[model samples]
Target chain A: MERKVVFAKPEALTDAPTHYCPGCTHGVVHRLIAEVIDKLGIREITIGIAPVGCAVLAYNYFNLDVAEAAHGRAPAMATGLKRVQPDKVVFTYQGDGDLAAIGTAEIVHAASRGENITTIFINNAVYGMTGGQMAPTTLPGQVTTSTPFGRDVKIAGYPLRVAELIATTSGAAYVVRRMVTKPATIASAKKAIKLAFQAQRAELGFSLVEILSSCPTNWGLNPREALEWVEENMAAYYPLGDYKVIDEVKSLK
Target chain B: MAKILMKGNEAIAEAAIRAGCQAYFGYPITPQTELLEYMSRRMVELGRVFLQAESELSAINMVYGAACAGARVMTSTSSPGFSLMQEGISYIVCSEVPAVVINVMRGGPGLGNIQPAQGDYFQMTKGGGHGDYNVIVLAPTTLQEAIDLTILAFDLADKYRSLVTIIADGMIGQIMEPVELPEIEPPQRPEQPWALTGAKGREKNIITSLYLGGLPLEKVNLRLQETLEEIKGNEVRYAEYMLEGAEIVVVAYGTAGRIAQTAIKEAREEGIPAGLFRPITMFPFPYDRLDEVAKGVEHLLVFELNAGQMLEDVHLATRDRLPIHFYGKMGGVVPSPAEVLAEIEKIASPQRGER
Candidate 1:
């Protein structure tokens, strides 16, 4: 009897094992992006700009032309690459601290300019690579190393709803928020990722997908509990939805 | 092309375009703003890339990206703006991508004034950005030299796969002079195997400044040092005027160098054996040549638009073999030729006798 293979790693991912801690969802998102690249048959024509976070070594995992950017400058770097090579698909992989805090200017301007690039923002509520610390997206009353007694709203402002902020930009064509806590949401996230890339391929303006991801090590929870926490706490604040879908992007097949 | 009267800033832009600079990203800053304005129109007309970035920080990173894609890229800024770009510049240098940067300097320790000054000497030549790296700095004295050096900047950047900076002041950036612009055909860029032009039919390339391990980072620093050593050996540039029988050598660069020429000529006619040593390359400074000049001359006078910034380099080069005199006007003051001549005369006078 002959058996058909149903599960295998995407070709877009290299054979190297990731350095992410156990239960971290960075691997899941990386695989999803690889799968999308494989489905689109664009691995050869894709360039990835990795941020200065846990995914700083993303170049090692993705089998594509990759460039590592200075902290919070990935969007600007992606714009540079895409402007010169419009035929190639360029994307940036950034974490919450990189996108929402230090790199806020770069991301905001990139969206305003309507630069034709895709961004995959991982909103994990804490700075992962440098150990757990309060990030721009850290929820109110959430405790991290820096916010030892839980974040105080009076001292630390409310968490930034990045997707909503990006949606308000006139130049943004597609902006969405999704979580990978369950298989259904994972599928929706992959769909959103594909649409963002599609928007770029169709010459639409900037597109971004903000993924509400998990950081078990930083959150001090098991991988299973982290998913439940994201489902219960993060999803409430950063509700999953299509925040911005311009007419041009919505019309894309 | 025939000699056309062009502002120094505009000529630098034209020369860069002629040299096949494919992309230009910059922000609006005084003095250097004209360069970005000129590119905004000309680059679009010529079907090249032009982007008015949000800030110098964004502009430098954009140039970094375009450069990583194997495109000839450039950016221009002033002192404070250049200060903001230090991080991106450090990353670009470590990544070893070819890029051109034009710094039309202004008075500054902190937003001092918009007038011309060379206070960035220590920053430009001594690695303004953090890390063990060096950028090739070219100081052009005249508009014609600005044009010529702007073109040379592209070639040198590409040749060394390093950042080449054109350090001018508001004097050179805002002044006007007739220049014969070179007509260069579009460059046929050699294939860069390391460039991140998608990995079509090849293994993917990674351009990064991050080396987590000690040995790997050390290797990167060692390699950068080796490249700098090569640049020092091959790219040191300076010019001498009336040094045939000179006893007193006035060392300057950019506007200071241009002004010193007049003073030297006036001193020459008055029987004072004064000559000018103008450095074209600020980095890989003419240390050896200055030492050679020291061997022939009795006194060395360093003049600049800043408070003796280059005097430190002059001191290092001469190694205290002879007395080094410094005359500088800080906070955007451009001393007249007569003022410099007076300084030269004071040094030349038998009464002020050999300090």
Candidate 2:
């Protein structure tokens, strides 16, 4: 029999211990991004701007040029990095709280300005780092530390369809939403990240892929239940699909 | 170089471009709005990076990103806008990224008037953001000094790996003065190995402030302290006028300092023997010089556009050995030269200048 290695970690991902909770799917999404960067042969040129949330230590895990950004300001940060160093592939890895809350203005403006960059948005309904506070994307009737009884649309407001919102921006080159809970979805999520990076490689305008992620610790469920919750609940509200592409953008290729 | 008549705000902007700042991220706010507008036009003409951010919060972070990527970047704001940037400022200092910030201070505690006020003296010198850190603050009074300091700000910031503040007031910002711009080619910054350009053919570079363990944080803080001590030793700057045989010295900076000079002259003609001691650098302030001056004066009168903020530094330098009196005008009301003169005259009077 010939010796062969069938599977291995992506070169972009460092051999570092992850700090994610047992059932959380952030590690899966991280791997998907790493694999995408590796396959594109862009690991050396990629500069990742990590947000101020659970993946704040993304710089440590990703074996590439990385910069830590203040909460919700990664998109704006990416814009600066990309604009100054157009040769460098700049991207921002932001969570729901970082993208939809305080950073909403940054993303909207970056997209509006048509910055040449990529954004990986992790849509976990709760604030994972602060111990499960209700996030802007928290589903209606979802319970978290901030919404003890359950989130009522009347009191807590409805969840923002971030993918759809970003899709509406004329400067957005590509906008997508994908799930990473299941193995099949993980492959698709990786594809989405690749397309987003590809758009940037072509000097396209802002590209974003919102990944529906699982925060089992914050959701008060096992990792298995979190995946099930995404299949049954999250996927329905934030239907996974390509919302926008370069064809619709006038300035981008 | 031919002297050009320019507003303080526009002069600072032109000086920054001449000083080799490649990128500028700013939001429009009064008093300093011209700074952003000038950069907007000049950057486009020069093919440099310029962006009018949606807000001050985004602007500072943009500077943060550009600076980490090995570009000299800057931003400008007023009081409320500067307050919004506290978090980013804290991060910048902690991450040790070199950036230049120009605060054309307006009256503040909140949404205060756009008129000039030196209310931000304490905010600028004593570290507005959270942490045990200090930024090298250069308080420029004259438009010429504003131009000179703005140019020096970029160099000193990069040289020390720290943020440098150009604290100007609306009085200086809106006024026109003749300034001889320095004629020097903007030197291209050599590659900084520490900056995160890319990981190609080299180890990855990370621009981060997170020190998880206390031991690591302690080490980082100690290193920062060491840098600060070096700055304190060599970077102190100030200017004194007519300090010889003075009974009272008016300690002021920026616009207030400019006004104090007029007051001191009138007081001198009145035979009051008053002089002006102005701090050129707010942080790493000319404390030793002020102490030297404090020993000769009977009273150190601190005048400001705020309710006695820089009085704290004057007190620290004098250390109660000398009596310090604070005279301030707040809420966008800048005292006239006569008002300051009266304060000096009152301090010299036997019946009025009592302890």
Candidate 3:
């Protein structure tokens, strides 16, 4: 008997290297998403939406057909694409600034409507793309370029807990928050992404996987220090947990 | 197809549904609010998506979403709301998403009036949004034409894979007229292999308009320019009345065109050889026919509900061959047929210096 080989390169487009700074977990999350599409054998039919913040250039790295949405409007655009082409896999990669701030209404309505699309929300606790601005997910005491004197709760208010808020909505089928600072966390992040895509494929409604990513350049930390910083400062504020898992809940319902 | 009396707004809404528009997203603005009211009552019974969005911005985005999903989606707004929607409209154009936008224009540079105006002519034709792009604009003169052109707008949108705007005014949206609804057929939608439903077993297709490289972006622009040229060549439409042997021609569109038609009738009855030229496709401007009319006529009168917006195009078409007289009513006022007829008579009278 003769053995035949059937291995090939990932179908994602081979574009320029990502524009994320060193130690930024956006690259890791991107690789993991690419791997999920490859593993699920859906790279050829997957469409990713790029938001206006750090992931704005997501079209460059993701080999699939990528649509760049205006700041904070990715969810709405994804809803359009997914509703029209319900057979193709649709996902949105959005940043904390884009998702929780300017696009708040879109996010809330899309979640409430349970639009059958996947959202990959990267919450770095700071606006990475726009030079260390205070984001909606910024930690309470963390100082950004904007919150120079530490986030004064009296004025700036506390950081928003998006996963928790979105999880309360009936439209959200799966909502999880996972950090990507270590290998174990990375493995769990991959699982979350796979399950989110699975929920989308099942037509179970909207799925969101919030990745707690590191922004070393924005955080004013070295690569290794940034990884440690996310593990130390961000993890406590945005605890890693599955807020809602539809497969388990549906079995009960 | 027997004529039935219908409110202009209700007729448009019914015609849109009958034409197989499965989803509608809109924000309420005065003068055109009845459109949304009609959709709200009808869409639920028809099993279609009808959402009164949080804002005009979100409404257009919802239309964008539904269009991307391969549904025949539409949205309606008045002037201020339409202005708010320009961002998403630009995105739809750049992404080549097929959808319909109905701008029942009221007056404004800012909330000008709730009545009627032809002020948005430049905004509709000259790329109201922020981009180097164009939307297929249809100007309907009657409630019947409103229904017919709206259905045609969807077809043109899909055929060209672009956005189409039915640019009417509050008069058309508010007035009652007899219209015959066309027999609605199930739309024969093209295969959207690029749509993002699920990967299933096919290759993932991404629909994007982001081309960073200069060479690739130029190629996209060239292709778009070519598409516009083809649209202009084939889609220019107009109605010419009494131009074969007339001394004066009046140019107008939408509500103003209907007024011009009446003016032409009155002028002829008054022993003045006056004609009317109504442009259906405002973007293409019907320059060829305008030139033809210009050659036979000694004077041209352009009437509008704005500060002589389309008159500029009429002048460009006639190349100043005939002296063009302008009559307009601004701030949501409609130019009456009597007023337009008076302008026609003024232009039709033999010039003091000429034979």
Candidate 4:
């Protein structure tokens, strides 16, 4: 039997080595986005805005024209870029800390305005870039740098459900929450990514797909356990399902 | 084109259109709300990009996005609102994106007042945001000057690839005057190899101000400093009135400068030799021209709406050789032309008035 190459690097992804920690899912998330852009034939005309957190170096990975936005301002930047060059496809890759906490105002307003853009929100539940600090998505009773005593719900508010909140906004044409830690969920995450891009291409308004990723180093667990943690804890709070989808997007093949 | 009587804010809006501005992002603040309102419609009708951002922070970042996309962009705001834009402005400065920001100044320190004030003189001329970067600031006294400078701002922005600010006061923003709009010649843009306009058939472009490691960041900083020095050497602008032979000079700009002109005429007719020095570009503060104006003058009276901010620059320019005085009215109070003359008369009095 002859073994041919079953896997190859996506041409849309740059050759630059990612600086993510061992077993971190940021690499997988990046690859999925690049794959979606390539499959849609938009890699030549796509512009991406990288957030200020761990994925701040996302520009180095994507071969498309990319710019780094301020900590939580990627959505606002995307609004401007998309509106200016309506013919080009624009998107932003933001992390939990960048999108939910510091940039809530930007994301809410951009979606409310029905901006023609796409956003990839990574919800790992902790601030991975800053050594595992408490994030808006931090689960109840989860310990972090700022919450050494196992996150007190009274002192620190409950975790924010970004997908649910944005789904309520009239402008969000497609909103979904998915996990990429398991092989089965990873396939669904890729499909969600594809559908989100399809929504943007159809000019159905704002679209977003929140992916629950693993940060083994920050979680103090091995790579395998980290995936299980996302599967058990994170998926429970942020359930995997479609939160919002417009009629036209739902009718897509 | 035809000379049209219009409000100062409206003229600035029309002028930006004539200058081939492709995008406008702004949040509504007093004094500049008209500018935003005008753009909200005109930009759409002209098939351009317009967005009323959620806040000043979003508005300025939007400008950053458009500039990164290689489009002519601008934003306008008032005092308190302008403060919120400092973070984004600092990023633009560090990234060296060419943009125009119009500051229709109002009272300061807090919500302040909506009335006309020059409290932002230092903020506009100096580096208001973090880092060692300066914005090219132009103070326009009249509606026509606002129209002219608004167009010039785009050229100077593209030429230097830096942020250029047109600093007007609430009066200039609200006042009505006849202005001849600059002819609409598609704006001149310089070569931008750093713009993030998709790869298409070219190499990928990244627009970021981040430079990790010491030596690399230092190299970028040193290059930016060199550009600033070049700007200082070439772009110094000012105007003089009755400086041929004078014993007293009133240094002012924007609305204060226009007020000083009246005071200079009255002082001259009252047998006191008085002249005016109006700085068109406040960053490169026209110090050399101020030295020339200070040659025969015994007193330099710097009048403003704030507390003696520009006087510091006057002292530096005159090298403290001549006696420099300051007369300011804070809290949104504009000094009358008579009040400026009275200060000048006090200088000319026998007692030299309380020094």
* Winning candidate number (DockQ): 1
Report the Cα lDDT for candidate 3. Answer: 0.85
Predicted model with the maximum TM-score: 1
Identify the runs in model 4 with alpha carbons over 4 angstroms from their true place. Answer: A1-5, B350-355
Give per-residue CA lDDT, model 1, range B9-39, as digits (tens).
Answer: 8999999999999999999998889999999
What is the alpha-carbon lDDT of model 1 when measured against the actual structure? 0.94
DockQ for all models, in order?
0.91, 0.86, 0.44, 0.83
- Evaluated against the true structure, the overall lDDT of model 4 is 0.90
Instruction: Give residue B210's lDDT in candidate 3 (0 to 100).
Output: 70
**Candidate 2 chain A — worst ten consecutive residues by lDDT sum?**
A244-253
> What is the overall TM-score of model 3 with all chains considered together?
0.89
Off by over 4 Å in 1: A1-3, B350-355
DockQ of structure 3:
0.44
Candidate 4, residue A34: how far the Cα is off, in Å: 0.9
lDDT of 4 at A248: 95
**Number of the top candidate by lDDT?**
1
Alpha-carbon interface RMSD for all candidates, in angstroms: 0.5, 0.7, 3.1, 0.7
Off by over 4 Å in 3: A1-19, A34-46, A63-65, A85-89, A130-134, A139-158, A168-170, A198-204, A242-253, B40-46, B188-194, B197-203, B348-355
Candidate 3, residues A137-251: lDDT per residue as tens digits? 8888789999999898899998998899999999999999998888899999998998888888778888899988888888888989988888888888888899998764345
Instruction: Please list all clashing residue pairs in model 2, or write none if there are none.
Output: none
Clashing pairs in 4: none
Worst 10 residues of 3 chain A by lDDT: A7-16
Q: TM-score of chain B, candidate 4?
A: 0.97
lDDT of 3 by residue, B107-194 (tens): 8879688989989988889899886888889999899999999999989888888899999999999999888998976988777775
